[model samples]
Target: MHKQIIFNLPVKDLEKSKAFFTAVGFTFSQKFSNDQAAFMHIVGDDIRAMLMTETFFNSLINKPVVNAKEGNEVIICLSCESRAEVDSLIAKATAAGARIPHPPEDHGFMYDQGFEDLDGHLWNLVWAETGV
Candidate 1:
């Protein structure tokens, strides 16, 4: 069985992507990063995101890369410890130049908000009451 999941995403600018994520509080594994790609740490070693330069990413796939801004690629949702944490991250992301596609939603048992990264990748920050 697989012990980890790494989501690969293509970006227009690797350095800008790294800075944006850094402001949102995501750390990278320097050991896995280089000029054309970065290993973004999401959940320790269990989950991760690979931000790759579009040219480098295209070389790995046969299909043309989707332009995230013009279309929906995938929404990466991450669980947060609390609703406050979700809001905090959203605030950070927005301050770092991300755009909010919609307002935050709260359902008593769950709360969620999302942002569009520089590369237009959609990411949702969610918090759920434990044991739900």
Candidate 2:
């Protein structure tokens, strides 16, 4: 069996988060979704992020939820096939309600852009130049 990674994130509204992710080109597995959370399938068997309601998350853990907006505890980085793919995802994410946290950065060998999801989770979309 192939190993997969699922990052669980707390959201204020499950439906809204679902809509946002869908608009940004992510498909969710309804089989894993319920009233409290939606499992978003990203990058086919490689990456996924679970959108869970605060109440549901609280029920699972005793620690307080980190306020992603106030401070980022983690930055999810996704590698892309090309620079255009990185740019396309950033534009799509922005149109889908994500806020661009920084201008696209070009590092000669790699290109990257940053955005904050509706719940303030940080995501870095990147592509590396093959010839570099």
Candidate 3:
């Protein structure tokens, strides 16, 4: 059985992507990082994300890269402890050169904010009420 999982994402610039994610509170694993890719540690058990340069990622896959800005291919969602935490991350990301795709929205049960990373990848930061 597999004990660990890693999600690989194609990026335009390795350094920029690393800097952006770092600013948004993610630490990288230097052991897996190099000029071509960076390993970002997500806040979960046995989960890591790899940010690979466009050329490097393309060399590994036959399919063309998804234009993340043209449309939504996927929405990476993360759960935060509080709404303030969500806002804080959004602010930090924006300050680090990420683009705000939309304003924060409240749905009573959940609060969500979105930002586009340096490579146009969309990330949704959410805080959901778990108590009934």
Candidate 4:
């Protein structure tokens, strides 16, 4: 059985990608990171995101890399412990130059907020009221 999931994403600049995600509170795995790629460590899960440079990443795939800011591909959603955590991360993301596509939405049982990273990757921060 598969116990872990590692997602690979393309980035234009490795250093800038590192800084952006660092601001988002994710650490890097030095063992899997180098000049062309970075392994972003996601806490509480074995799912790590491999941030690879466009050229290096393209070599591994058959299709060309899309311009993220111009086209949407995927949105990475993270579960938060509370609304406060969601708000805090959103602030950090915006401060780190991420653009907020829309304001946060709150329902009786859930709250959702998100931002687009430097490379235009959309990340959603969500919180669900426990016991729901």
Query: What local distance difference test score does each model get?
Result: 0.95, 0.90, 0.88, 0.90
Tens-digit per-residue lDDT, 27-131, candidate 4: 998988999999888864677899999999999999889988999878999889999999999998888899999999999699999999898888899999888
By TM-score, rank the candidates, best first: 1, 4, 2, 3
**Which regions of candidate 4 are displaced past 4 Å?**
none
**Predicted structure 1, TM vs. truth:** 0.97
Clash pairs for candidate 2: none
- Predicted candidate 3 versus true structure: per-residue lDDT over 1-132, tens digit per residue: 997778889988798788888888899989988999898998865778999999999999999988777776788887889999999999999999989978999998899999999888888999999983
Model 3 regions lying over 4 Å from their true place = 1-3
RMSD values, in order shown: 0.7, 1.5, 1.6, 1.1
RMSD of 4: 1.1
Residue-by-residue lDDT tens digits, candidate 1, 15-131: 999999999999999999999999999888899999999999999999999999999857999999999999999999999999999999999999999999998999999999899
Against the true structure, candidate 3 reaches a TM-score of: 0.91
Tell me the lDDT of model 1 at 31. Answer: 98
